[model samples]
Target: MRNNGSDVLLTAIAPIVWGSTYIVTTQFLPDFSPISVAMLRALPAGLLLLLIVRQLPRGIWWLRTFVLGALNISIFLSMLFVAAYRLPGGVAGTVAAVQPLFAVFLARLLLSSPIRPLSIVAALVGIAGVALLVLTPRAALDPIGIAAGLAGAASMAVGNILTRKWQPPVSLLTFTAWQLTAGGVLLVPVVLAFAPHLPAPTAVNLAGLAWLGLIGAALTYVLWFRGIAKLDSSVVSPLLFISPLTAVILGWTFLGQTLSPIQLAGVGFVIGSIWLSQRPAR
Candidate 1:
């Protein structure tokens, strides 16, 4: 029971940590390029963790690591950065929050998890809430940003399913280290090819990068995997619904962004959906 309590606490915190990424990226990181930021976040943190772990995965685990790395870290973060850059933070965040829906659908198809009716309804409600929050006439409607956010969510969903399917023998830290390393390696060429010249890193940017690499990617994954290991996906995944709300609040507080009445209503819907999704089936 104590272990369960710890897992729940950790799971709840992971998304809140992730929610800060938007503010960090927009305010701190250099305006060099999204891919560059993504690479830096992954590479250094990956190397640090790998050095600490020092035990490499073997056999089929290598392939699994690569696939998970691509889906979870590389593709997901890269596209998320792009969406954040192109779209309003609220829009990007709200779109990314659709991850729960994607996760539910993929879990059904891949993990053979039961797709409860309430889960589907909750997902749709959440989606509608996000749409209300983000769709504004003043904000530039970039199809590319929308596409990137959805793709990132899809990648995350696939990665979540894969994490369940391919349970590595290593500790959560070790597994996360390998995945980060693989993702960083995959991103290197892309970053080099696209963003060879980086912007001068300011103190603020460096601080943001450090927080992102260390806390957001590294510590968050450690906690996330630990929670997933201890809890059922049904219990663990819905906790992610808190992420966008955190983003919204953070955006409002730190970034001085204001939420419209409709957007506030949207947030209520999202919270309601998340709560509903977490309840045990009747």
Candidate 2:
């Protein structure tokens, strides 16, 4: 293993960059179909990475790759869009925040990682902070949206654990490429059947797609999978707290969204929880 500090820092960048997705999607791709955007975001990046690696799955890896793809990318992204469109952003985000806790338990069940009390504490704090940061008293919840959020969180949690458990005999880049490509491929029919034809993209829309495909999907997932392989799932799961934190900050900074005192306090909680989760258990 290399420097734990460096691994954490590098892995953390993926989610931080992901925080910009909401901002970019709204400002540039607002009129785009969510499923189509997801497909575009995934497929191009997957193909680009495949081109670089020039590798394909073999034997059982074929099934494993697709399963991971469905859990991690295709289903997760689909549920994310469904929740975001059907429910308030805060409700969706907070509900999905359960992912860390789910990861902890899933790791214990699947990977036999220790279930430390500190891990539970950190996960709880992280969830509370996200709720504070995003949830609104007036936010209306739809049953389907709530279900999607929960399912998405569980899907991602299982995917994270499975990635940690599988340890594919390939470089992180190849592993990432396989999952992304598989996921994008799975979404082809969904987009074709459900989504209408997209209008010709302007320069800004193309730029947004480029950033999401190149940076958000390809680069970020590479970092994320690297983290999953190197770090304990408990350690890596809490890092996702940074995504919502970054989102809130971006909203305030770029979108001129007002941050309440509660949200600021939630920010503190999130930072503290992250730091706490990374601490080695005594």
Candidate 3:
């Protein structure tokens, strides 16, 4: 069993790595369709992990793996891409930001995690912070996009809860591999149906894909699933704040983005919210 501090840190690494996706997508992968990019990232990573672990799901594990894969990866990612395409980046981000709260609700209902008043307040504050931090004044709401974004959040939240509910019989490595493969395979038809013509691949594109697959998806997810197994869903949930926080930092450092006063305050609020959510119930 991992120590609490180590589990927290390991769980954190997943979102931090995910936060770099914006930079990687912008800098390394340009002009690629979102679905195609997702397919590349997921399928290759899943295959790579399968090769390394060499364990296939058996009996009921197959169904559970596919369900987890669809919820966590295929369906969640599909809706996310839809929201990103239909809505402004800021609007989509704000909508997706409510995921931690959803996780909290699911945890309380399903995992029986204590529903602390402070955690609820923290989630609300975190949502407000994300809105201020990411939502621009000109951002307009598209109902379909908004729905997709919320659904995406809910999908992941439920996935997190279900993962906790269903313990894996195999090692985390093999279990993680199974979900990734199942999810990636499920996404294949979606990619074929929606995005048939992929962009021409370059050396840089391949390199970026490799980085996203190997490091971002494979390794980070291993850490993430293990954390889910060991930690409370609510505890693991709030750590997602690290993703946007890291994104804000990357934007400032690498892209010369500046934070407004409101955004700076939002950052503080988000940090505080994450801290509050992780605290033991009083």
Candidate 4:
């Protein structure tokens, strides 16, 4: 029970780290194109991790690496950056908060896990909370951003399902490194073709890049896979709700973004939903 508690706590930390991503991206990264920023985030970190692990994928795992890498890192981050660029930060985050809902459905379909009605309810409530917090009548709703966010969510859902389905023989660190490297390699052509001009890199930008590479990508993924290995996907995925809520708080406090009453209520709903979702079902 104590170990379970610790694992949950560790699992919780991954989202908290992720929640800061928006604030960091907005404040620190150069106003480069989203794909450029995404590539920068993935490539160096992936190389660093690969160097440390120094393990090559064998047999069918090579395909698994590419597929999971695309779903988890390359496609998900690219879509997320598109959403972030096109929509309000809060709205983009709200869309991302629906990840657990997608995860639940995917797990049921892919892993043959039974979906508890309570899990669905919790996901809906959490998503409602996100909507309340992020949506506004005055905000310009971009179809592209909406699609990007939903696509990002779905991509991540597929990646999580794949993680459950394919257990690599490598250590958690090695597996994560391989996936990141693969994802980064996939981004090169896209970056060259679309984002030809790189933004002027600053010390702050460098610092932000380092943080995302080391803490966000490498360490966070290590914790994520560790939790997935130990816990049910149904149990592990919903904990992601903490991310957007944390992002909201960070945005309010650090970014000087004011939260409307509706947003506050949404935050409350997200918090409550996460709490409910994390509870062990009867």
Candidate 5:
């Protein structure tokens, strides 16, 4: 078994890598349709993992994998992309910050987990920090985008909870492979029907897609699923704050973006929230 601190940090790699997705999507794969992008990102990585594992879901697993895939990958990515396309990045991010908060209640309903007051407060602080970290005063929201963002967050929260509830009798690698492949398969028809018209991908586009598929989806998800299995869902959920924190830092480092005082304060809040969430229940 992995140590607690190491597991958390390792799982955190998933979101930290994810923080780069925004930059990659905008800079390198700007022209692809969101649905097609989602499909390509998930399917290829999933296939590669499947090849490595050399196993397939059987019996009830087929259903479970598909359901989990829809919740975790297909629906979540599609809605997230819709929100990204429709709303300012800041607006989309702030709206999605509700995820950890939503997970608390959902866990109560589904897993019968305690409604820890501190956890709630931590989630609120995390939301505020995300707003400060990512939201701009000029952020504009579309109703559809706001709804899609919430749906994406909700999808992910439920997926996290269900992943905890339903422990597969398989390795984390196998489980991750099942979900990703299933999710990618579900997106097949959607991509065919609704994928936006775009020009052919250049070599740069292929490189970006390869990064997203291999590193962003395949490697990160193994860590994520393992974390969900080992840690409390509440603990893992709050770690999502790391994604935004990493995003802001990347912006400063690579994009020549400057961090204001408020954003720095937001970083404090995000860190504090993660700490509070990980603390043992009083």
Candidate 6:
């Protein structure tokens, strides 16, 4: 088993890479088709990973992968995008930040991990920090969007809990491919039904797709599941705070955005909560 420190660091990379997605979407990707972008990110990355791994899942794992893929990729992405379209990004993001809390609950119910008080408190603190960091004064809540966001978080939380509970029998790469391919395959109809069409294959579009597929989906997920297999779900979940924090840093560095005093405090809360959550359990 990997040490906690190494596992934490490895898990951290997934969210940090995820943080870059916002800027990449805005600056590089073609406009206005979230479904296509999601589909392209998942499917191609999955195919590449499958090719690299060159292993198929065993019988029960086939079913498990389908279930996991649906929750983690297809449903989560679909609901997340629906929420994003209907609500302010901040609102949707804040709702999504509740995922760690959901993971806490699911971990308790599914994995039989005793609930830690500190972990719960840390999750709340992290959610508040995400809110302060992303929620705008002008933000308004739409019921549909709120529901979608909560649903997305719930789906992802269950997926994480299940992943921790059911350590795959295959190698990490093969396991990753299983989930990705299943999810990607499930997304086909959704993409066909919803997306107007695939984004034009311009140079920038291709680059954007490549980055999202290769780095964001394939590589990042491999790192994520490795952490999941090695660490508790709660331990892996709190690292998600890194996503927003990384996004803030990236925006400040690249987009010339400045953080307000409140936002800086939010950053502190996020970092502190991560530390508190990861501390040795009493």
For candidate 2, write residues 1-282 as lDDT tens digits. Answer: 232999999999988987777677777887788788888888899999999999999999999999999999998877876776676555677778899999888888897887899999999999999888988676788999889989988999999899888889999999989999999999999988988688799999999999989999999999999999888888898998888788778878877878889998998899899998998867
Error of 3 at 49 (Å): 0.7
Q: Evaluate model 4: give its lDDT.
A: 0.85
lDDT of candidate 4 over 40-68, digit per residue (tens): 88888888988987889999999999999
- What's the TM for model 3? 0.92
In model 2, the runs with Cα more than 4 Å from the true position are 1-3, 87-90, 138-140
lDDT tens digits, residue span 46-102, model 1: 899999999888999989999999998999989989988888777887778778878
After the best TM-score superposition of candidate 4, give how far the Cα of residue 273 lies from its true spot, in angstroms. Answer: 1.2
lDDT of 3 by residue, 133-205 (tens): 7776666789988999899889999998999998989998888788878888998898899888888889998
* RMSD after Cα superposition, model 5: 1.8
Which candidate model has the greater TM-score, 4 or 5?
Answer: 5
Question: How many residue pairs clash per model?
Answer: 0, 0, 0, 0, 0, 0
lDDT of 5 by residue, 41-95 (tens): 8998998899999998889888989999999999988887777677755567777
The whole-model C-alpha lDDT of candidate 6 against the native structure comes to 0.82
In model 1, the Cα lDDT at residue 177 comes to 98
Global lDDT of each candidate: 0.83, 0.87, 0.81, 0.85, 0.86, 0.82
TM-score of each: 0.93, 0.95, 0.92, 0.95, 0.95, 0.93
Which is the leading candidate under lDDT?
2
Q: On a 0 to 100 scale, what is the lDDT of residue 228 in model 2? A: 90
- Tens digits of per-residue lDDT for model 6 on 197-276? 66558888788779888998899999999988888777888998887777777878888877889888899999988988
